[model samples]
Target: MRLNDCLTPAATAIRRKAASSRELRSNLRASWGDGVAFGGMVGFGETYLAAFVLAAGLGELTAGLVGSVPLIAGGVMQMVSPLLIRRLHSHKRWVVLCALVQAAVFAPLGYAAWQGSISAPAVLILATLYWASGLATGPAWNTWIGTLVPPGVRPRFFALRTRASQAAVFLAFLAGGITLQLAGGGPHLMTAYAALFAIAGGCRLVSAWYLYRHTEPSPMPASMRNISWRELLGQLRSGNGGRLLLYLVAVQAAVQVSGPYFTPFMFRKLELNYGEYVALIGVAYLAKVIALPWWGSMAHKVGAQRLLWIGGAGIAPVAAAWMVSGNLAWLLTVQVLSGVAWAAYELAFFLLFFEAIAPEERTSMLTLYNLINTAAWVAGALGGGAILFLTDASHAGYLIVFAASSFFRALALLLLARLPAIEAEGEEIGLRTLSVRPNAASLDAPVLPSLPSQAE
Candidate 1:
């Protein structure tokens, strides 16, 4: 009787494990497809919003404002996301709602374009509501996914997810860009814009449906525990997580200083068509796809903080590289460099961040972190706008902003030294099993000798 009883429980446990594995696989496949559609939507829509404003005869400063104002409002929305999520009692629900609203916002944009009323101010108003709704979905989705993915599998999963998404973005950008050029070859370019936006809306609607179908592992409670402002401030001053957030903020701000104006510079000054613009971005995305696996493998061996340093240092020169040339080959080379650098940073940033937080704290901390990040990005865009205003949109003015961005990026790299070289959720990092360095070949010996903990 005792043997039978033990066997029954053991057999039941095996069955349950099998069932869970099946579910995880199902969710992962769904999520992968979701990523594909979402990536396509971003390429078709998000990447072109500023450019569309420029094409609509809004000029450069208005383009900057269209990107900035909506984003700032969205950042403000993030502040309330935690409270709203608590009241709603479901992260997935919040994500679905927001995603749908973001999708719906684009419908009007398409109509506005068709109606010939898509002015800069109109874009700002519509985009704010669009971006705010969209931005609020981010932290919620991150937190919800945190619960879905097993901790042991996060690095590989995230890296793969990123690679897949980047690949999709590249392909979609090619198709969308070609579509735009062909459409604009017609009698009315506004019709082309409208068609592009309609496709984007459909892509987003599919993403929302995927969001709805993803299995919610558990219902988030109505209330979450949060640390006091005083406590959070202390951590920001001294803790690893806080410092990491600071580093991300600094880097994003530096990037945005010139990021928003790149399209304007390319379109107005370089005289690139939509196809050429998409090609530049596509090259970058391709580089990331090629580089992701190597970066992912290195993550387990060298640690995310160290990789962050390498990425930051690599990225610092890329924006400034723009000022050196307008040659297509040179710009393509810059885009490739930019993509490789950002892949390392993006992969490490997320893994380390999730590692630092306890599961219980993810909802609040992620939301707050995103809130601050959005604000920093908006501030950087505003700073760039100010510079453009002062320069009166001269070629020299654009160059000055680009140069300032590089300087700030280099400044941001200084923060990496302050971060600890630890695994996402483990002890201080040291010489570990080194993976094959991308450029180095084995000479029947280890490429990297186990050394003292710090590379420096």
Candidate 2:
């Protein structure tokens, strides 16, 4: 009794907090599994796919198409997500099944590579299936996670989750680069790709397992309003929300104009070894890991819109910077700068997209927005491919394409400049203060959305 009486209230408080912490962990346990699963995907995606395709004897056009065609197909595939959700009664079910399919898509590829069956067209077709499965999962999964996390913890939780995923991606990318280089580029390289992709698929299956465990708020909340096509079209025409969506499409179109070609340029033209290529790409991911929070802070200080402008304008010069030098050190510097700008632009875009759309409507809007965004990426890829083709895939051609990409990015910034800034009450929005969702009443936010199109 004497010892208890002597004890500080702070000690009791600490005990209480510890108990609550365990309860919190129980509630969010599924999300933890999901995070681990997503980390696995970092090992292989579009970037690695580019390396694989090129090593398979495909040309620049094939590399560009690797990113482009899948996105184009995925966008079209996503249009059906809402319908699937309607039939399934649970977003988790849809996500889990489709994700398993995505993983399985890799299995056949391994067999094909071993059989000498891998080719540009075969890769494109298989990749299309791979992307279709994953992309379809996104709409359902984003909607599901949005309902899972409470807002008070969303900012920090999402940031931490994203950092973890990015870290995994960085490590995975380093591993892939090493595997490709050590394995050496030749006919045998296809076997290596098959094995790596198979492993990557297994990772996704793990993610699916975690997703299956996640606790989702009832898939259909009470009295929810379903947005119709006419309303969606109207938003595109005069709504502030539509403008935000268009801003993204514009920015991405600008970025992709030269984005997909970087692989071909470096690996084929500059002849950077797999390690060097990985270094260039991996640095950007690392920068993202380090800089995302900084960007979030800047967004807090200045405002998401202002940072977006800075990011938008800042991003425009990055592709052009490559034109100034082919030196690895110089290119590495360019990647670091690009990573910072990417953090700013990407964070701002995520926040802006969520802020402008309503909660119950996110599933529908995101599905549509992603579809359009995917289409824009394809357009950008096609534009880059055309430039390279016209120039005979020459180094000069790449420079010209890079220069054009810069112009388009600047033009996209101008569009952003015309848009209105997001207003906040009592406090400026930072990653800490924000959840990147629609109205919490029924909104969905993608804390760790699979940002596949971003780097690759």
Candidate 3:
């Protein structure tokens, strides 16, 4: 059956199920609200912290390194997180633990910065703690989400959540930028930024608390004794999994290579003031919010792989636009495009990832996926820095880096083309021959209706 035809009954079923379940409805609303709040506070803290680091006599390379190092460390650590989760047998508890750790770390980092001891090493250490928190939380978070959010409703639900989150991020950026502007880039400004971080940390704590309150249906453990490195490697070599891995790695490498430099490029090369920088990012995020729902719907309609291609194809020109123009107006325009592209890429990627794996394998697959993505980001940052150093920070250096990255992303898109499209969870209409695990009673209500026993 055609993909769209298969999806009709599933969509109808989901609407019916949603109308029937008051409890599920309430949980969905809460999750959406919490997600928005968490995203906003974090985005605010990140922008302010980054600007503060730049203002404190750190160079572009150092600032970029600050962001990239944690990712690298997290990537390396992520390989073990799944094993830890398996041993612990509790994803939710680990996520809360990570959040608590983050809160503890942030409070001190902010206090120290307020006391005027913000050094490169100090920044790196704080970042390490932060990223470690991320490493611990990410796989578990994804795993939990997989269970909580049903597949049929994910597109619409995520679209709403992302829209709200982006809106929050927009406000946070504006607030942070305004605070910095009022403080006049002096030692006092550090206190304001530090306070922002503290508040952001508190917000995360609240989010963690809310998450703990969420009821997750328990998952069946993998029958295997342990997930070995060899087993992971074997999975990576199998079927569409291998191809998807390569595509993800390549896309991550491409973006990360040039991604870390974006803020630095604005600060160093363009000499954007704090307010302008915040405004730029805020607008970009807003653009992303506006574009996300469309992308989500498109993914449901067409397929994720095609959307990936669109995202991959768009990056190069967007990067090249920055190289060519270097004007704020033009830069903002490109950032808007980049935001749309990123939204499409992210939404489609997550949906496709969930579709790709079995429920039993999700934790391991998610951990491995995050590990590779983090590793790619680190490598990209380091590689970009190396290229910049070699070329003595020339404009040509950035152009060369972005160009190469874009080319590789395009290559990844081409690779993605070879993989078969997975059916959307509810959308399987006439294919009764292929077997699927029905949702158990303990599982959330089936969002999509079962397909007809036989195709017409």
Candidate 4:
């Protein structure tokens, strides 16, 4: 009887582990499906919010603000994710709800497109809803999925997932651009936008369905506990993580000074058709995609910190490079350089900063970080908007904002000086095992330093 009792417990454990392994495999596949569908939503829908604002006759300032400002509302709303998850007792449920809401947001956008006009207030409100729902999904989803994906596989798994996501983003974006281009300079342009947004909404719904398909092994991991301000503040203090966060926020602020206005600049001042605009961005997108493997290899050879320096230096002059020429060829050259630079910068931080956060605190830390990051983004965009407002959104005004962005980016590099290297969370990384890197489609947003790598 004693031997039988002992053997019984061991047998039960074996069965449990086998069950877990099966679920893990299932969850990983679901995540890939989710990635592809989510990428489709982002590509068809999220990338064009500002351009839509411009097409709606909202003027340049409004177009610029649409991309960065609503993010603050999203950030603030996501702060409640932990409490919501605690009450719901299921991260999966909360995430699915958020994703569904995000999908729904595009419906009204499509409607507004059909109408061919939406007030600035109405547009901002819809954007806030869109961003709020989208941002809320990040923290909870990160905490939930972290448990599903084993640490050993995280680097490679996320890399492959990122590749899938990027591929979808590129294809959907290209299709949307082509549709708009085909519409030509005519009344049907808004109709094309409507169709794009509707398709985007559907893609997100499919993404949510896949999220539902994921098996939540643990409804509440120990990591989901409340984090005290003392702990939060400790994470933000002037250590490696803190300095890195601050530097990243600064860089975001610098980047946004001109980032949000580029679309309008292309449409208005440059007089580029949708095809030319898409071509410019597509070149950059393709460049970034092709360069990722190379950047990953470089990171392995030189270490992530050095990689960060290389990327940082590469990006600083990019905005200013815009002032050197308005010629399409020159702009395309700049974008190729821009794509390669951003890939390195984004990958370095994914390795160094994201990996440094303890898994136990990642949920709360990222939730809070989202708020601060969004605020910085809004501040910089507002600064540039003010410049454009004062200068009447002229070509010279655009040039000024672009120059200032580069200047600030150069100044922000001061913080990166003397930074301590933090250990990465998993194994050595390359294209073979690197984390997420945003494609050019991500440029429409503030590109907050927080990893879409984790929450995305």
Top TM-score prediction, candidate number: 4
For 1-456, candidate 1 gives per-residue lDDT tens digits of 565476677797897899999988887787777777777776677666777787778898887667655676766887777778778888888989998998898898889778755766678898788778876776577657656766565545554665566566667667778877777644476777787788888888998988888898775733345655566557566667887888888887887788778878888889998778877867776676577567867877887777777788888888788899999999998888887887677656656765655555555665666567768778888898899999898899989888988899899877877676656622221110100111110000000101112111
lDDT of 2: 0.69
In candidate 1, where is summed lDDT lowest over 10 consecutive residues?
Answer: 441-450
Q: Give a tens-digit lDDT track for model 4, residues 1-456.
A: 665476677797997799888888899899889888988987788787888898999998898888889889878987777788879999999999999999999999999999898999999988888888988777677777777887667767776776787788889888989999999868999999999999999999999999999988788886456787578878678457788888888888888898889989989999998888888887777787777768777776787788888888888998888899889999989888888888778677657765666656666776777777788879999999999999999999999999999999899899999587655422223221111112242432211122334433
**Candidate 3 global TM-score:** 0.80
Each candidate's lDDT (Cα)? 0.70, 0.69, 0.63, 0.78
Tens digits of per-residue lDDT for model 2, 1-456: 676577689987887789767655764676766665566664564447776777767888898778665866777778777688779888788888887888788787777766655777788888898778877876666666656665666655665665566556557667777887887866777777877877777777887887777666568655345678788778767766677777878877777778788888887899988888878877766775577667766776887777778778778888889899899899888888887777677677766665655566666676677688778878887888898999999999999988998888888776776777675211112221110100000001244322212111
3 versus 4: better lDDT goes to: 4
Q: Which wins on TM-score, candidate 2 or candidate 4?
A: 4
What clash count does candidate 2 reach?
1
RMSD per model, one decimal: 8.0, 7.6, 10.6, 4.5
Full ranking by lDDT: 4, 1, 2, 3
Deviating ranges (above 4 Å) for candidate 2: 1-27, 186-188, 424-445, 448-456
Alpha carbon deviation, residue 12, candidate 3 (Å): 32
